[model samples]
Structures are given as C-alpha cells and as structure tokens.
Target chain A: MKVHVIGIGLIGGSMVLDIKSLHPDATIYGIDTNESHLAEAITLGVIDKVGTFDDLAEADFVIVSVPVDVALTLMPKVLDAIGDNTIVFEVGSTKIPICEAVANHQRRRNFIATHPIAGTEFSGPSAAIKNLFQGKTNIICEVEKTTFKLQEKALDLFRSLGMRIRYMDPKSHDKHIAYVSHLSHISSFMLGKTVINKEKDEQDIFDMAGSGFESTVRLAKSSPAMWTPIFKQNKKQVVKSLEEYISNLTLFKELLANDDFDAIFNEMQSVNKIKEILNGMKK
Target chain B: MKVHVIGIGLIGGSMVLDIKSLHPDATIYGIDTNESHLAEAITLGVIDKVGTFDDLAEADFVIVSVPVDVALTLMPKVLDAIGDNTIVFEVGSTKIPICEAVANHQRRRNFIATHPIAGTEFSGPSAAIKNLFQGKTNIICEVEKTTFKLQEKALDLFRSLGMRIRYMDPKSHDKHIAYVSHLSHISSFMLGKTVINKEKDEQDIFDMAGSGFESTVRLAKSSPAMWTPIFKQNKKQVVKSLEEYISNLTLFKELLANDDFDAIFNEMQSVNKIKEILNGMKK
Candidate 1:
C-alpha cells in the first residue's frame, strides 16, 4: 500500500509508526510545512520518504494531520490532488470546520473526518512512539458523508491501530471534545501561568511541585502552534466550556472566601465521582 | 524505638511502610478515630499494634498524619500527651495553623512541623504503598522551634526514606504550597466538575478522556475527607492563589472570545517552561 502523511508531527508521525507496523509493506510518504519536522520525521524513520502535493495522486491513502486551520485549507486541495481510489482523512482535534470545508466537494465521499482521542503533552516526530492509538477512542464524524468502501478502509486502519471507532456529527464531535479535551488544555495552561505569575522563585515550584501539580499542569507543555488553532476553531464551544469551568472555580472560591468548609467538601465529594468514570477509561 | 502513627491512612501508613524497612525491630502502633481503618492497618501489617492516645507517653516518636483541621486540634494534645524525649511531628499539607496552634505550648520544642510532598490520588490503608516517599521532597517548617536532637532524628528518618529535606518558615511553606499544591487540587476538582456538568453522557467522558484530561483531573478523585480540611486550614493563602488562577483564566477566556489567538498562543508558550520544572521534579 502507498500512504502519504501530512504534518509529520506527533499525531501524524505516531500514525505512521503504528500503521507501518500493521502493514509492513506500506510505503509512507510524509509532508509538512515545517521543513525541519519533515527532516526529523525522515531521520526518525517515521516515514519512508518526504513527498509533495503532487505525490498525493499516486498515494492510496492521504492522512492530513496539521494544525486545524491548515488542515481546513488543505483538505479540499488534498481531495483535488488525490486519485478517485484514494482515501483522504484528517486527525485534527476540531472536526466541524474541516467537515464543512469539504461538504460540497465532489470527492467528499473519499474524505473521512476523524479525531483520535489519544496524545501526550509532547510534539513533533521525535515524540512519536509505537501503539500511540492502542485501546484509544477514535471519533469519526460525518462517516455517512464518506463512501462505504472508504469508511470501511478507514475503520480497518483505525482497528489495526487498536482504536474503537464511534460515529458522530461534526458539530457534536466539536462540542463533546470542547468539554473533554480543549477545556483541559486551557485549564492546565492557565494553571501553569497562574503559578508562574505568582511564584517568582522557580526553585520553590521545583521543590514543591508534587505529583498532583505535575499531572494538573502537564498539558501546559503542549505546542502552541497545534492548540491555539484548536481553541480558535472551536471558539464557541470552547468558550462555553471555559465559562462553565470558570463558574465552578468561582463558586469554589466563594466557598473558600466564606470559609464554608462543608460546601467545599461536598463539592469535591460530588466531583470525586470522576474517579470512577476515569478508572473505567484506563486500559 | 517505639513509633505511634496517628490517623493511620495513606500518608501515615506509607510512612510506616518505609520506617519499618529502615528500623526493622521498631514497634509501630496505629491509631485512628476510624476504628475500621485501624483494624485494616493492623490486618495489612502497616502497624505492629493498635494503640490509644494514652500510648503517646510510651512512644519515642509520634507521627501525626491526619487532616489539617484535625492536625491543628491534635497538635497541642499530642504535645501535652507525649514525653519531652518524644519527637512529635505531623505530615499535614498546611503548616501555619498547626504550627500556630502549638507555638507557645511548653512541649513545643519537642514537636517538629513537616509536610512530605508525596502522595497518590488514592487514599486509606489499602492505598498505602512501599517507597512512596523515595526521591521526594520533605519540607520541614519552623526548624528552629524543634530541638537539634529531634530535628536530627526526623532528618534521619526522612533520609532513610530517600528524601531531600528543605527548611522553611511555617508561613512561607503554606503560601508556596498554596500556589503549587493546593491550587492544583482546586483546579483539578473544578475541571472534573465542569466536564461532568457538561458531558451528561458518562460514557462519553469515559470514551473521550485522553491522557491530558485524565492527568489534569486526577486530583479530583482525591479523598474529600483529606483535602477539605487542608483547604479550610489554608483558606487565606489558597484564596489568594485561586484568585490569581481565576484571573488568568478570565484573561484566557477573553482572548478566546476576542479570537486573540496570538495572546493565547504566547501565554501557553511561556507556561510551557513548566515542562522543565516538572522534569526536574521527576525521580
């Protein structure tokens, strides 16, 4: 099989690794606007070769994995560049824009909009590792928009990477992810910013950063180039999620101000149910 | 040496696990208002025996690992109840109130203030594990208040657990921890609450919680019985830290609302430096 990977960074690069393992004979071509990332992906053996847009015509499958804005612009072009038999898909976080962009395209039946619910707080090809998608959730939005054969082929690849596929409309996918994923990035970034703003002594943070702080602020290390676009593309839903988070924080702050220990305790106790929900998420 | 571990839960139980490895022949007594927890500790071999408050006089070292509000109440009593030779110390998250509670007590010199910056999301005797403190930081506040001999003994135990000890005043310890530790708990709890509030489908949360959301909300699963008192006792400092966090979030929200993607991107880029600080904290 001939496969072409765009935006050869963490998500796309990881896909290359796992997909190669599943189909050892697959020849994976890579593309990225960042020249260095393309070189790094090649050095890391994440792709068989670096390829250009013209190369897309010969590929059997094209994986678009750039920042959402770039992916939106590139989606139709990728469809235009690919042969009739080629399946074009993207692994962007926000799905609505990309889906809407290709909605009226004649080749829309060949494009599948996907958001794989898997990542670490690292970026670039070097961060790619084996089994990045294993046992993870993959949301395939507007799967009905794709031809049955292309959808099944995408599902085969998703299954090969050990992902459980779910179908949703692009709108629901964006809204749901706004709550579960994008809001977390904002919360963590704000947390790191808050601590950095208050504690001038970095040594103090180093000494006191327990596992709790480490986990809570871990997402602050995510790439701005990747995430800023996600938040911007999903602005309305993300803003709603952020408002809910800020409201919850405000209520807790009021409880703290009033020294209403019981209310705070009850609030945390109720939220502690997340433990059960999260425990179910672990493999 | 005879050791009495009060409140026999995660912290105290973990200490007993490490302390017994260091002083194999020492007898460890467990005490808790929760009778079942004491019994579970005994069953799990976390303690040599269950003991009472009256056992304080017989203990050469008293480790008070209870909730902060309870620790504040028990600090003076444990001091009043123990011998001058007994080195009484509490492993509570907040230090100011506990330190202040016993400031003028006649036996104050025998009591040491410590906050070992190590823990897991889980709690209780069953949640205790070996070497939980290894390569972790142990903050000893108000070191001058304790006698040299007692401080050295505490240092010996902390060293045996493979900890690096740093000394700070009670006020500074509470303030710094508010930013790094306490604020993290609040952020995580609020994040969990916010997500749970929006995603009515528990299955959706269980499906979509990536490592980012999982890590960011890990502390939300923490025992409310334990954290409620810590926040209550350190309300002033925590409120201050939380206000800064909320302000930061509000700014980020405004940036999102205005579609100021550059500002959001720059903010996260700066906070990404936390990756280095957190890296230094890892074992």
Candidate 2:
C-alpha cells in the first residue's frame, strides 16, 4: 500500500511514522508547504519519500493532516485529485468544516473524517514519534459517507496502530471536542498569558512553577497556527465552553471572596470527580 | 539530628524520604492529624518513627507540611513546644498567612517560612517518592525573621537535598504564587467541570480526552482537603488572579464571537510566548 500524508507536522508526521513502523511494506510519501518541515521530516526518516501533489493520484490512502483552516481548503483539492478507489482521511480537531467541504465531492464516499485523540504540546515534523496513536481513541465522524471498503481500510489502519475507534455525527463531534480539547488550549494559553503579564520577572516564574502549573499550562506551549484555526472552526461550541468556564471561575471567585469555605471546598470536591473521569480516560 | 515532619502526605512524606536518604544518621519522626497517613509514612520507611506534639521539644529541626489553615493554627503550637535552638520551616503554597500567624511568636527567630514549589496531583503517603526536591526551587520568605544559626541550618538541609533557594517577601510570594499556582488549580478544576457537564456521556469524554485535556485538567485531581485551606488563606490574591483570568477568557470569547480571526490568532501567537517561559523554567 502507498500512503500520502499532507502537511506532515506533529500529527501527520507521527502518523507517517506509525504507519511505516506497523506496515513495513507500505510506502509513505510526505507533503508539506513548509520547506523546513519537509526537510526535517525527510531527515527524521518519517517518510520514505517527500512527494508532491502528483503523488496523491496514485496513493492508496491520502491523509489530510494540516491546520484546520488549511485542511478545510486543501481537503477538497486532494479529493478531486485522488482516484475513485483511493481512500482519503483527515486527522483534524474540528470535523464539521472538513466534512462539509467535501460533502458534495464525487469522491466523498472515498473520504473518512477521523480525529485520533492523541498529541503532545510540541509541533513540527521533528516532534513526530512512532506509535503516537497507540492506546488512544480515534473518533470517526459521518462514517455513513465513507465507502464500506474505505472505512474497512481506515479501521484496519487505525487498529494496526493500536487505536480504539468510536463513531459520532460531525456536528456532535465538533461540540464534544470543543469542550474536551479546544477549550483546554484556550484556557491554558490565557493562563500562561495571565501569569506572564502579571509576573514580569522571568526568574520568579521559573522559581515558583511547580508540576501543578506545568501540567495545567502545558497546552499553552502548543503551536498557535495549529490551534487558532481549530478555535475558529469550532467557534460557536468553543465560545459556549469558554463562557461556562469563565462562569465557573467567577463562581469560584465569589465563593473565595465570601470566605465560603464549605462552598469552596465542596465545589472543588465536585470538580475532583475529574479524577475518576481521568482514570476512565486512561482505560 | 532529629527532624519532625507534620502532615506526612505527598510533599511531607517525600521530604522525609529525601532527608533520610541524604542524611543516613538523621532520625526522622512523622506526625499527622490523619492517623492513617502517619502510619503509612512509618510503614513506607519515610520516617524512623511516629510522634506527637511533645516530640517538637527534642527535634533539632521541625518541618510543618499541613494544610494552610491548619498550618497557621498549628505552627504557633509547634513553636511553643520547640526548643529555642530548633530550626523550623513549612512547605505551604501560601506564605503570608503562615508568616503573619507566627510573626510575633517568641521563637519567630527560629522559624523559616518556605514553599517548595513541587508536587503531583496525587497525594497521601503512597504518592511519596525519593528525590522530590532534587533540582526544584525552595522559596524561602521573610528569611530575616529566622535566627542566623537556624537560617544556616535550613539552608544547609535544603542544599543537602539538591535544592536551590531563593528569598522573597511573604506578600510578594503569596501574590506570585496565587497567579502561578493557585490560579492554575482553579483553571484546571473549572475546565474539568465544563467538560464533564457538557459531555454527559462519560464514554465520549473518556474517548475524546487527548493529552491536551489530560494535561490541562490534571490538577483537578488534587485533594480538596489540601487545596481548600490554601484557597481560604490566600482568598484575596486568588480572587484577583481569577478575575484577571476570567477577564482574559471573556475577551477571547468576544474576539471569537466577532469572527476576528486575526485578533484570535494573534492573541494565541502572543500567548505562545509561554513556550519560552516554560523552557526557561526547565533550565
């Protein structure tokens, strides 16, 4: 099998590595507009060859792994370029836009919209790793639009990479991902901005940042180019989640101001239910 | 030398283990309001023995590691029970209240208000690990309050455990920590609450929680008993930091609602400065 991965950065590059590692006979082609990333991906041996758009015509599988905005624009082009028998899939955070963009394409049945719920804060081709999708969930949206053979191919590919797959509607996937993923990036970036703006002394922040701060602010280090588009594409749901998040923080502030120790403590306890939720996520 | 550690949970127990590991001949005594933690500390070999308030008189060094509210109240009692030559210190997140609570104590000169900014969300004796303080900063506030000899003792002990030290005023310490540490906890808890409330199907949350959400929400798993007191004692500063945080989120919401993509994208780019800040912290 031959797989063409476009915009080979963290997610795409890592997927290339995973596919190559799992299917040694499968040939992998990398595509990226960023010359430096292509160079790094080639140097890192993340792909068997760095190829151009022409490669998509012959690709058994074409994976769109770019910024959400670019994914929306480029996905249709890739779909138009691919053969009817070729399977095209996207690993974008927001599914609705990408799904809609390709909804009317003649080869729409050849496309599968998937988001493998896995990533590190780091970006670029150099950040890619083998088995990045192992033990993680890959959400497949609007599976009915995908041809049975292509869906089977995508499932086999994810399964071979050791990922569990779940199905959801594209709209529902966008809403759920906003709360679970997109909002997290915003909260982290804003928290980082808040602290950096207030604590001008870099040395003070260094001295005082514990693991709690590190973990909470980890997403702040994510690439702005990658996240900004996600936030924009999922704006409505992201806005809703952000409002509720702000409301929650404001409620906490009021509780603190009133010295309502019981309320403060109980609210934290309620939120602490996240422990069970996180533990569940681990499984 | 004899050292008594109060509240032998994650931070306290880890400190005991590190101290004992470094000073093989030092006899360490454990104390906690929770009997189970005290017993677990001993069974885990984190301390040489278990003791009560009476043990302070004989302790060459006394380390208070209880919750902030309890630390403020219990510190004075420990001071009253300790010898004039005893070197006392604490590892609370907030320092102003503890510093103020013991400001005029007769043995104030023997006390050192310190915050070792390191810990995981998990707590209790089982969470203790060796070398917790290695390569971490131990922030000592109001060092002038400590007698020269006791200061030397505390400095030497922290050095022995592979920790670097920085000195700051308690007021600045609490305010800075409120932004860097306290605000992070609230953000994490609220993020967890927002997601959990929005995603009623636990399976969706479990499947969709990528590393981004997991890292951002990790601190929500922290103990309420431990965090509640810190929030109560540092209420004012926490409220201020939280207000700034909510304001930032609100502004971002407006930008998103307006479809000001450039504004949204640029804000994230600016906030991406956190990557540099976090890189500096790692150094």
Candidate 3:
C-alpha cells in the first residue's frame, strides 16, 4: 500500500513515521507547503519520497493533516484529485466544517473525518514520533460517509498504530472537543498571557516557574496558526466551556475573599472528584 | 546532622528521601499526624525511624512539609518546642501566613519560612522521590525573620539537594504564586468539573480525553485538602487572576460568536507569545 501524507507537520509527520514503522514494506510519500518542514521531514526519513499534489493520483490513501482552515479549503481539492480506490482522511481537531466541506463532493464517500485525539504542545516535522497514537482514543465523525471498504482500510490502519476508535456525529464531536480540547488550549494560552502580562520582569517568571506552571502552561505553547481556527470554528461550544470555567473560578475566588475556609475546602472536595473520573477514563 | 521531617506526605517524604540519599549518614526521623502515612513513610524507608513531635527537639534540623493551613498552625508550636541550635524550615506553597504567625515568637529567627515551588498531582508519602527539589527553585521568603545561622543551615541543606535559592518578600511571594501556581490549580479543577459535568456520560469523556485534556486537567487530580487552604490564604490574588481569566475567555467567546476570524486569529497569535515565555522559563 502507498500512503501519501499532506502537511507533514506534527500530526501528519507522526502518522507517516508510525505507518512506516508498523509496515516497513509500505511505501510512504509526503507533502508540505513549508519548504523547511518538507526538508526536515525528508531528512528525518518520515517519508520514503517527498511528493506534491500532482502525485496524488498514484496513492492508495491520502491523509490531510493541515491547519483547520487549510484542511477545510484543501480537503475537497485533494478528494477531487484522488482515484476512486484511494481513501482520503483528515486528522483535524474540528470536524463539522471539514465534514460539511466534503459532504457534497462526488467522491465524498471516499473521505473519512477522523481526529486521533492525540498530540503534544510541539509542532512541525521534528515533533513527529513513531508511536504518537499508541493507547490514545481516535474519534471518527460521520464514519458512515465513507465507503465500507475505505472505512475498513482506515480502521485497519488505526489499529496497526495501536489506537482505540470511537464514532460520533460531527456536531457532537465539535461540542465535546470544545470542552475537552479547544478550551484547554485557550485556558493555557490565556493563563500564559495573563502571567506574562502581569510579570513585567521576564526574569521573575523564569525564576518562579515550577513544574505546576510548566504543566499548566504547556499547551499554551501550541501553534497559533493551528489553534486559532479551531477556536473560531467551534466558537460557541468553546465560549460556553470558557464561561463555565470562568464562573467556577469566580465562585472559588469569592469564597476565598470571604475567608470562608469551609466553603473553599468544600469546593475543592467537590472538584477532587476529578481524580475518580480521570482514573475511570484511564481504564 | 540529624533531621526530623514533620508530616511526611509527598513533599516531606520526598525531602526526607532526598536528604537521606544526599547524606546517608544523617539519621532521619519521620513524624506525621496520619498513622497510615507514617507507616508508609517508614516502609518506603523515607526515614530511619518513625517518631512523634517530641523527637523534633532532638534533631539538628527540622523540616515542616504539610498543608498550608496545617503548616501555619503547627509551625509556631513546633518552633516553641525546638531548641535554639536546631534549624527549622518549611516547604509550603504560601508563605505570608506562616511568616506572620511566627513573627513574634521568641525563636522566630531560628525558623526559615521558605516555599519550594515544586510538586506533582499525586499526594501522600508514597508520592515521595529522591530528588524532588533538584534544580527546582526554592524561594525563601522574609529571610529577615530568620537568624543568620539558621538561614545558613537552610541554604546549605537546599544547596546540597541541588536547589537554587531565590529570595523574595512574603507578600510578593504570595501574590505572584497566586497567579503562577494557585490559579493554575483552580483553572484545572474547574476545567475538570466543567467537562465531567457537561459530559454526563463518563464514557464520552473517557473516549475523547486526549493528551491535551490529560495535561490541562492533570492538576485537578490534586488533593482538595491540600489546595483548599492555598486558595483561602492567597484569596485576593486568586480572585484578581480569576477575574482577568474570565474576562479574557468572555472576549474570546464573543469573537468566536461573531465569526470574526481575523479577530480570533489575531488574539490567538498575540497570545502565542506564551510559547516564548514558557521556553525561556524552562531554561
């Protein structure tokens, strides 16, 4: 099987590496608009051969893993260029727009909308890893939109990469992702902004930052080009989640201001249930 | 020199282990209000022996690592019990209260009020590790209150543990930490609550939680008992930080609602400076 990955950045590059490692005999090609990233991906050996959209006709599968806005604009064009036997899939954070963009395409059935629900704060081809998707959840939205054979092929591909897959509607996927993923990026970014804004002396921030600050602010380091669109695409749900998050923080603040020790303790106790939920999710 | 660690939970137990490993000949004693933690500390060999508060007077150095509230309450009493030759220090998140509480004590100068800005989401003695403080910032607040000899002892111990010491005022320390440390915990807890509350079906969260969510919400798994007092003590700064955070989220939400892609992208791009700040801090 020949696999061609577009936008060979973190997610796309890691996918290529993972696939190559799992199936050594499989031929993999890569494409990216960024010359540096293409060079880096090629140097890293993330792809067997670096190709362009012109070569899409010969590929058995084409994976679009670009920024959300780019994915929306280029997905259909990639679909149009692919052969009927070729399966096209996307690994984007937001799904509604991407799903809608290709819903009416003649080869819509050849496309599958998937979000592997995995990533780190880093980006670019250098950030790619062979087992980036291991033991992680992969959310496949509107899977029925794809042909049965293509769906099976995609499933086998994800399984080989050691991912657990789940199905959901595009709308629901957007909403839940806003709460779990998009809002996290915003929270982290804003927290980082707030701290940087408050601490005029950068040296103070450097001297005072511990692991807590590092972990909490890790996602703030994510690529703005990628996340800015995600926040825009799923604005409503992201806003709602952000509002609830803000309200919760405000109430905790009020309790603190009142010096209501019991209230503060009780609130923390209530939220501590997060441990149980997180543990359950791990299982 | 002999050392006695009070409340051998994560911070204390880890301190004991690190101190022991650094100075193998140093006889270490563990003291805790929780019997189970005491036993676990002993079994983990975090200490040479388990003892009571009475053992504090016999040690050359006494380390108090407990919850902020408990530390504030017990520190003065412990200082009263310790001899002038013994050096006493604390590793708590907040420093103002403890400093104020022990200000007028006769042996106030014998006590070093320090906040080592290091910890993990896990708690209890079992969470202890050998080099928890290595290369981490150990902020010594209001050193004026500590005697020169005792301060030297504290500095020597921390230096031996491979920590770089930073000096700051207690009030400033509390305020800065409120933004950098305390607020992160609240943001995480509330983020966890919002997701767990919104996603009624636990299975959904379990299915969708990626590394992004896990890293963002990791602090939510922290012990409420440990965090409640931190929010209480650092109430003012937390409230201010919380308000700013809410306003930022609301503004982002409004931008999203308007589908103002330019505005959204610009804001995210501006906030992307966090990457530079975090990277600088990591170095």
* Per-residue accuracy of model 1 over B7-122 as CA lDDT, tens digit each: 88888999998889888999999888988898899889999998888888878889999888888778888888897789999999988888889999999999999999999988
Clashing pairs in 3: B109-B147
Q: What residue pairs are clashing in model 1?
A: none
DockQ for every prediction shown? 0.90, 0.86, 0.72
Q: Stretches of candidate 3 above 4 Å error?
A: none
> Residue A81: error of model 1 in Å?
1.4
Backbone clash pairs for candidate 2 read: none
> What is the lDDT, from 0 to 100, of the residue B73 in candidate 2?
85
The number of the candidate with the highest lDDT is 1
For residues B185-245, could you state the per-residue lDDT of candidate 2 as single tens digits?
9999888888888888887888888888989999998899999989888888899999899
B220 in model 2: Cα distance from truth in Å?
0.8
Task: Give all candidates' CA lDDT scores.
Answer: 0.90, 0.88, 0.84
* Fraction of native Cα contacts reproduced by each candidate: 0.94, 0.92, 0.77
lDDT of 3 by residue, B211-263 (tens): 77888888988888888877777777888888877777777778777888788
Chain A TM-score, candidate 2?
A: 0.98
In model 3, what lDDT does residue B258 have?
80
- For model 3, give the TM-score of chain B: 0.97
Predicted candidate 2 versus true structure: per-residue lDDT over A1-283, tens digit per residue:
8999998888888898988877789998988888888888888898888877877788998988889898878988898889877999989899889888998988899999999998999888888988888899999999998999989988998998899999999898998888988899999989988998998887788889988898888888888888888888888999989989998888889888988989988888988888888888777
In angstroms, how far off is B221's CA in candidate 2? 1.0
Off by over 4 Å in 1: none
